[model samples]
Target: MPQIPPPQQQVTHVNPQTLEELPAPVMQQIQPITPGQVRSARSAMEDMSAAAKTSPLTPIPRISSQTVSLSAGASIPQVRVFPNQATTVTFSDATGHPWVLGAPPYNSSPCATGGELCVGYIPGSAVFTIQPTNAYASGNITVLLKGLATPVIINVKGAEPSVKSKTVDVDYRLDLRIPKRSPDTPVYTATPEKKISLYDKQLQSVLDGIPPEDAQRLKLKNAPGSTKVWQIGDELYVRSNMQLQDEFEKTLSAIDGTHVYVLPATPVLTFSVNGQARDVEVELN
Candidate 1:
């Protein structure tokens, strides 16, 4: 109560050395980034990511439309190789830039027939060689390129010499009669003229020459005379008569219809035989 009578002032004491030595707090300056600068930095990062995701270059090969044909029991057919024999495929990128290709494996199909046909390609080569095991039968040889969907089809033909024959009876009327009053008698006799020989190769050639559309309308028939004919709808007939004159006429008519065309006697494809060299034009799909 005695101290409350007057307001008392309190004095605080500070050390002079501590106050004098204490340093003032320093303010640090921080630079703020603008919206434009932030946008530019993000764009640069996106560009770098796109470059990292780019794919390597790849090349494609070229092939020809005409197929190669091989004969049964024949030596291996030599194929004309692509230029440089590099076996490197060439392809253009989305940027229209061309690139060379690395080596790839090949695949081949077995002969459709029971026989085996040797088929293969050399490393870095587009040309495929063919060799047949036997002359048993004919079939198609298929070759596949790795990474490609389409296949190369090579035809193999068997040229074995075979003749199929048939015989029929022919009747010729004789003028001689036994008695003056005896009724006329009819006699039937078989003749060599009725026999026909069918050549296998000739028949195959005719069938192969027929157009797909016309072939669907034709059917082979076995007649009494051993003669074969392409019968069309009962009304139309394309006969293979043994007579030379008739045969010539029939062949001409068949070719004129645009349904049949004669193939080479040796049945060769575009390439030459006997190790002849030829330039191959190939276009890849």
Candidate 2:
């Protein structure tokens, strides 16, 4: 009866100093994203991550090495280095062996002050990284390795690189063969132990299309042969499809049709073609 007596108008008191409870704010009408939209956003994020991971290098690293020989002597080879950049020199011959980089035999001007070039080497390996701070920096580095009568001397020089300057100068991964010594040649030097197996484990890297650091990849030009030649030291070796003569000893014949044979750096090789001996002249392309 009291409630029915009056539908009283509600009165609210407002206070400026004291806080008052207010009705909860209505949550924004949040539009929930559907599974497809969520998937699309996830896919976009994944694509971005993939792209970032597989981005191409600004300047692709290239192998531009040539073949050269190493002999026992005081002969020093020159390596070209870039200013403010590092160039690596690998003794492809002693890739897995231990070698010591002795104090550089000699250094000049800026190099003497240790400002022109900074030199370092990988542990227990004959790999050197030369960093040049001056554009015209130059110096000599001496290295001693087992099986050598004399130490290896490298001349590091600063150079300006061209588009085609990434050759052996930049890396110096050349075919370093000890100039063939005759029986009469009297040289007191330690030599690598004679290998008993024809299938040298060192060749596994070469068979996989990545030349072993010791293998000297021969650059061919206009050679008339399906065989590719790699010179490791003074010995000539090949991975070829040619049916070699019975006399051609092979270390491996992969199921992939690659037959590896080694020759004594000869100019001609005997191949069995059509069941006939075809004397193919081994020429470089």
Candidate 3:
């Protein structure tokens, strides 16, 4: 049989600096830390410090303008952020593709109020470049300038709370003016009257039966002859001339409802048209 050696006994050392000194074996068992972990810990501290100083949210101003150009047709505008202010602006498209637009990039930096949030529209990429560090101010740029084709939601946060959002529609026509510098002013000019064909009495009777409420909404009372006419919400109540009643009845037969109420507009004397003064039957519509 092989013989086994007995374990050695441990001893403690006392020192002037401390009450106890650990055994040599105990001290040797402790492993040294790697440099990589130390570097990672330092980096984490730096990141936390940066986050503490930067704000997580921003705001945008409520802007109103009449000169919006809807030609872009659903693209977000480019935005420039001014100095000393910050805001958060968001954009969404019909495709469920969403992107953020503001002074600073969503997680980049902060914006300065009274500063510029310059938004330029690019139809292709639908991207906005926010310059939070830009030196421009609000008054220097036009907030209502039509840049994008689509609507955008803007949240302006800083000195004041403001929110604005709008979906723009495209204007199919070009805007032309006879050389005027001021957009704030209105331009008007009067021209000679033009002749137009008039509606006949039979047509007028049909027109007259129209209820004021319905006529006003359809704008049919004073429209031109060729305009394609269509009825609105409910079926109309109609009163017709006697001679036209039979013809009108056939027309009403196609329209489903008890809406047509026929009455004569004038009295018919039996003897007047024939040669005798017989009993007269008057038809009023």
Candidate 4:
């Protein structure tokens, strides 16, 4: 009985390679991922990543996409003010809204030098006054409006209260008059030629009578090509093409007591407006 002990139970072992070759179980269905879900998941992941990177003590930088610019308008009219005199400047916004005075800060060059130019603004009114110290205190007063690219320029001129006065003597003997030509003088005839020759001789005589000093004072020599002597009514006009210097009037006044005739000429003052040279007529009193 011992020798015939029960047959041992048979045992079998499968190789790992054989189990790996076996087919996987088939799944019945699966949920399809939509594009919206993918996007949401990706956004959530990005937000989480950003939150992790940022600290509570750190400040996030902000960026702006729009640009701002100042308003541009027509050039303001040139302001002319006599020294020690005051004038107001009023301006409106691009939308026609008047600017509040003193709201936009203003600055002036050579500021508050006691005798220098002074600029003051009146609150609640869109006006600013500019004043100089005296007639002799003359210079450019530039008023800059904050946030404005262009400045309001005021030309301060020294207008003296007193003007030199002198008597001007005229010689009626040198009066240029057009003689009445005889109607009997026929055109294209010897009579007309003789009349023209006589007129030329008379003109030469009148010219010769003008003294050399008088000619020099009148600036007749080296005068421009456009210079002309015109006789209008009882007055004589000597027009010179070039601008006369300031001393020209003084010279004429010095020659007042003489036989030479003097005709009043318009006086011009040359100045700069925003770096551009300009001429303005000045009345002499």
RMSD of each: 28.9, 15.1, 21.6, 32.1
**What is candidate 4's lDDT per residue for 1-285, written digit by digit as tens?**
467778889888888777653333322123256679989999999999999765323212211110112235533223334443455555433211243433633444344655565667666654566555543455665544434444555445433332343221111111111122222223342122222222233233323333222232222333333333433233333333233322221111000111112244544433333455445443332
Candidate 4 vs. true structure, TM-score: 0.25
Best by TM-score: 2
Give TM-scores for every candidate, taking all chains together and pairing residue i with residue i.
0.19, 0.37, 0.20, 0.25
lDDT by candidate, in order shown = 0.29, 0.52, 0.29, 0.37
* lDDT tens digits, residue span 80-142, model 2: 765545676654331122233333333343454656777765565445667777556777766
Count of steric clashes across candidates, in order: 2, 4, 29, 0
**Which parts of model 3 are misplaced by more than 4 Å?**
1-37, 49-53, 56-131, 134-137, 142-285
Report the CA-based lDDT of candidate 3 relative to the real structure. 0.29
lDDT of 3 by residue, 72-92 (tens): 453223333433443323232
Report the lDDT of model 1 for residue 60: 25
On the 0 to 100 scale, the lDDT of residue 131 in model 3 is 35
